[model samples]
Target: MACQVQLILAIFAALLAALPFLSLNSFPIRRLLYPTCRCFPGEPCWPSDESWDAFNKTLGGKLIKTVPIGAVCHTNQSFVPYDAAACAELQAHWNEADTHVSSPSSITAPFFADQSCDPFAPPSSPCSIGTYVQYTVRAAGASDYRATIEFAKSNNIRLTIRNSAHDYFGKVTGAGAIAIWTHHLKDINVFDYASKHYTGKAAKVGAGVSMSEISQALKQQGLLAVIGNAPTVGVAGGYTQGAGHGMIASRHGLAADQVLEWEVVTAGGELLTASPSKNQDLYWALSGGGGGTYGIVLSMTVKAHPDEPTATAFLQFNSEGISTDLFYETIATYLHNTLAITDAGVGSIFQLSSAYFAVVPILGLGKTKEKIDELVQPTIDALTSKNIPFSYESTQYNSFHDAYAATTVETPVAFGQLGGRLPPRSDIEFSTTSFTGALRTIAEKGGLISGLSFNVSRMPDVPNSVLPGWRRSTISLVTGLIWNNTDWNANLEAQRIISEEFIPEIDRVSQQAPSSYMNEAAAREPNWKSVFFGDNYPELLRIKKKYDPSGLFWARTAVGSDTWVEGSDKRLCRT
Candidate 1:
């Protein structure tokens, strides 16, 4: 007991000692110092194999040693019969699709983070252990999450919360760390949700539940959920954490806006409930401030809307025969008409490629098909005047599930990077020559556009942390670069251009200080705090300090994660 007290005192002293040298650009060394009070990995003080074994025993053999999922290619001995063909196929699968790698709760896609982990590097690079978590506790229940948090806290080790592994920013895995995988905690319950702050018919879903699972499950109850377009995304994970947006968001608001409460385990090793009334700060932080930062989410109760008939529009125009100038004018015209379309109760995802498409999911929900057509006539007129060939389809569905199933376009994963922006309404339809020019400049960048009806007339009854700009923004604009997976240089180049070139251009044309959707934005975005959370960032940081002062949960580019950066070793280092 004496020794334990002394140890605690020493640690506190060390932390205070490390604080004086700290600045926004520099992190305290104590942040990374392990149990032995060491400063470096090779100084004989790092956690040893014996220590790991003991830790494993404490968890009842739940500790998992890290292995490169792609190691089959390099090592054929001591495991299985060497199959070169099989190894090559595995690499191909890992390279091309986020779904394959993101499938395993512990297996994060390579490109999601900085791709700093050497294990997922090109074949030419020697295979080595990456910055990935050395051990993961496959948490099946809340008790497991609590235990992991306590263990990490006592040991002064970093903790990472992983659910679904679908984060575009790769918050799921961290090297030299122990992970709590919440993917198996898939309990979804339906009941009358009553809270001091809110009362409604709601579904309380475990942290691991995906958007598709929720959508399909709600379909059985004749209900609708405002979920991201991708079916594979985790509904209760980073999606909600980063203020989830979708085609139906204009009506129901963001997925985060749908939350009534959350069950969470904080860094203090206490399981708590966060809601509009209970633990309100944590609730605000979890609502839209960011994910993998506040605490490990056990489950979330969200308001459920009764399913309604949806008018779906699937329209496409070919790029051939139209001059580049005419195409630019067509895009400007489309932006010009967004105000009326958005006002008429519609939400859409527009693609600007060889064959441009605007797939409106909840189209003219309270109006007629003719009304929807009239709203879109200006753009159609421009296309027709240019003699542009186009295809069009309009139908009504009993549920959003049916509409999405019939009209959804699959976006296959590739070696790519994505950067997003929320374009102000004035840019969309102010109709001035400069505004038109700015819209053209933005569209000329040519990427997927997912936004509609940001002209919200009313705000949420209770104040929370969802980014302030989302209430006024007209479109959620995205610009990205997809490259050949086999060529790693091209992958690196794509990331460079996304941050250095494309994002700046988007910011310039929009004439804003750059705000982005946290989940879908670039990992290395400059001035990320205000850009992701806007005026809410400072309050969110206060909540983070209150809940996780030790900075136990760190996702790359997450709120309050500035003290550390990823090193070439794939390990996180003090800045």
Candidate 2:
């Protein structure tokens, strides 16, 4: 009897473990019996042609069926004749971010798109939609947002939200899913904003507004708001929702901190405003809880400050004349002075490798070029005294926009997986040995260490739900493995190293238990709930459940996403 009982228990345990995977096969029967799984293309419950037509009509013909951008190269897949010239042009500009952002369905990260469509492939090769969203709604306003949410909910289809498509962590693309593309909602309204709590100049920017557009609009009004390094990044989307940090973060605060109000469309298709005094929980959740989870934000009203003079610095050095050890040592010296640099209200974006070091640009709000040079003097002196060949430049501009234009360097997209940690001040101040060792190990592994350093210790005590680590962190350190799209085995190993090896090296020595910025964190990060939100995750989850009770929103690492699982077919189903 005991032997029989043991066998039964083992069998039961195996079945329980296999439950999530069971739905992958015979999905039609399983879905019919349970009716709990999300509907996808070719499924019995998927929306029919008439249903899609009706929905499109409601939006005044705004619905779009995705045609993979690379389809132009595949005659069988493309609607039009294959044009070799167009295919060549697409291949040439594939890495440029603007190429993807301009399209309704193309996301900047092609890895997430699963390479189902590749312009580089021979014309005879297959070109399927793969992981790209099957259909997109060019949401022009609130009514469109509401209708899309209602349709998604009633149809039991996986819904995705995308703006600018600048996602690094695969949050925007979903296979066999429908997405609301907010890239065309470009309305920027600047005014003298006044409320019961405070009064000032603010801009109510539409969800589609990019950093470049908003900066230009605000500059025209002789004002500025916190913006990210990428000008193409949307102002009211994932950037701010993930607690935006930028070149002036130390001078102001996070972009989330600048938000005064959010106009959103909820999961239930109701339009509402979220702010400190109204829908308080929704306000907190939307501020930094990560986008596409809480609601579909239509626009955000953010505090704008008067334009100011700005200075910037650029520095670069390579290992041509210096030893690798000496190069890292120079990097260490620079890292050691991060606290002082940020304290002086300077913010910077820098990169490191075993063979080179570069500070793309450092912003000094209201500071002159002389002051900028003084702030970097210690690192310059260290390089000079050690006879390290280097190039450095500091320039002052009449306005912050001019400085931004001069310093901004466009970056490529969809190249690799990203993993990072927000290293608290203690790591640089007290636990210097372990911190330095971690960075060295990463660089030795060919991981690019991109550091965005700033001081947020002075951020006002507010109720937003950003990673608590942000306030205590001095630098956000990101390192990752770059992989060519065709290598599955190599890509798997790269993901494992970044999630399991590279990030852990930094986590082990972090004295304050620092977390990661959700927007740039690794896709498979361990203990992601804690790594992304820390102590605030529980509350964020509670708010997610309350607002989206049926679990209408799901992203890879967004709040409360563990309940759903993606199968081999790339379909999202309830676990």
Candidate 3:
């Protein structure tokens, strides 16, 4: 009988864990160290059924109960989330790039990184709620966002923001909380008149607008927006928030530098217009401080450039006859001469491994194939001297869209990943010996290396909270190790390596933590304040308090997240 009672209690606990929202009797915990934490650890706080119904009615029935995307392929409960045929289809395409992106509840980052949800594996096993937001308010406008914010604040309910869910870190989801899904807020408005910041063509993009949507739309108007190469990434989501970098960075500057104005719903339940001339503090923080840390963005306007023709250089070579010495020499030569290459108006993605090295660069607007050839000719000559087996191509595209489409990389979901960063040019240019030594040492660590170099002619006038390393960084080094999504143990070891072993070795050599671009680095990065935001962190935190004093917004490793920690139950419990 005692054993039976224990079993019943365990089952009761499981039900509570899975409950989306609670009854009205859940009063605030006075003993709680973190006042902003709406739910108690292991004792979730949920809204009453009546309150929930009211909230749903307020949104005109946009709210939906939590049904994780992974539930389709597998389930933690006795029943699956879908029919057998649908489950089979999900399993078949589980590892594809777009499968996860298009799914409402799927997040690009490993869902069970915290190891909270049982059978936490992707598609194959049930992606139990874990730390994911329990209820998603599919926001259709600023009012929806504002309404959601007010509810979360007044009820002391933890809130998470989800747009594209392409975030590498698990910022978009939180365990046992309300979520604002801005993905449905798709609105695009164009302007030809002058504004406080810029006096040229501009695009007023909704928070849910994606890279491809804006790209294709602007292409028809003979205009272009500086954006990442991915087709599914949300334009105003984490992309621009982390100071987005891409093929056109050399020509147009980082995405954060293009912002002219932003429409946001703050923690105080008021709608705001943030720009250079208004709410300057919020503007700076929102520009690149990292999303989910400030407030929910409703819309943003960015300067648009004339859609022009582009030139590109592509090189792919197998390390068939390449020696270790020759490989390092090639890497060293590129590092030593990045200025000249980027000065010629080119941005590149270099993927290297012991077995292979590939470089695809999109030249700037108005540049020609000869110019592309002239810039990359040196690397080609060096490889030629080394007798390296190689193939090269230089092409001219009539539109930037054409050039961008040719070399865009689509990263698949379901694989666990992390990055090792390289500091700015001052660190890379420490000395020839130091530069190449660090490069060769980290590169030879065995994996893939994705390198990015940024060269800019002009920057926006507003101050931003982007990583200080970006100001001086010429090249960023990133390498990732992947494991089968179903192999939980392998995923564990991979995450351990990315945090404990991989990034540390590179950070030791590259001045500090892998500070490449914040959005793409490891979420559990050490001393992230100095690495991701640098000196700007202090001010960003100040602004965080100034606006959202309750610490209402929190992401895995965003600025000012040090004061809290996530528990095994997936709750952001106070320390």
lDDT of 1 by residue, 209-318 (tens): 87778888888888777787777667888888888887777677788888988999888878899988789889888988889988889999898888777776666765
Report the CA-based lDDT of candidate 3 relative to the real structure: 0.73
TM per prediction? 0.86, 0.92, 0.89
lDDT of 2 by residue, 1-575 (tens): 98986786566456646885543224343344437567878865677899899999999999999988988877667555788999989888887889999888887766687767777666877788889888999999999988988888767778999999988767788987889998888899988888776589999999999999999998888899999889999999999998999999999999998899999888888888998888989999989889889889999999999889999999999977888778877887888777788999889888987778899888998899999898888899999999999999988899999988888866787677778899888898887767888988898988888999999877554579888899889998889878665675787788889988899889888886659898888878768899889999999999999889988888888998989988998888788
lDDT of model 3 at position 149: 83
Please list the C-alpha lDDT of all candidates, in the order they appear: 0.68, 0.85, 0.73
For every candidate, C-alpha RMSD to the true structure in Å: 6.5, 6.2, 5.3
lDDT of 1 at 11: 80
Candidate numbers, best lDDT first, in rank order: 2, 3, 1
Residue range with the least summed lDDT across 10 consecutive positions in model 1? 23-32
Q: Lowest-scoring 10 consecutive residues by lDDT in candidate 3? A: 24-33
Report the alpha-carbon TM-score of model 2 versus the true structure: 0.92
Top candidate on TM-score is: 2
lDDT of 3 by residue, 1-575 (tens): 98986786576556656874732334433223235445642443456678889999999998977766556555444335545577667667766657756655566676443433322344344345666676889889978988888777666777888888787777877777788988877788877848655799999999989898898889889999999867788999888988888778888888999988889888887789988889999999989888887888999999999988898877878756667777777766666556677776678777777777777664556688888788877778887888877889989999998887776767666565777575656555665456666556545665556787767545557677677677667776676777565566776676677777666766566554446578878766766777778788889999988888877788878777777777656677556
Residue runs of model 2 more than 4 Å from their true location after superposition = 1-34, 75-80
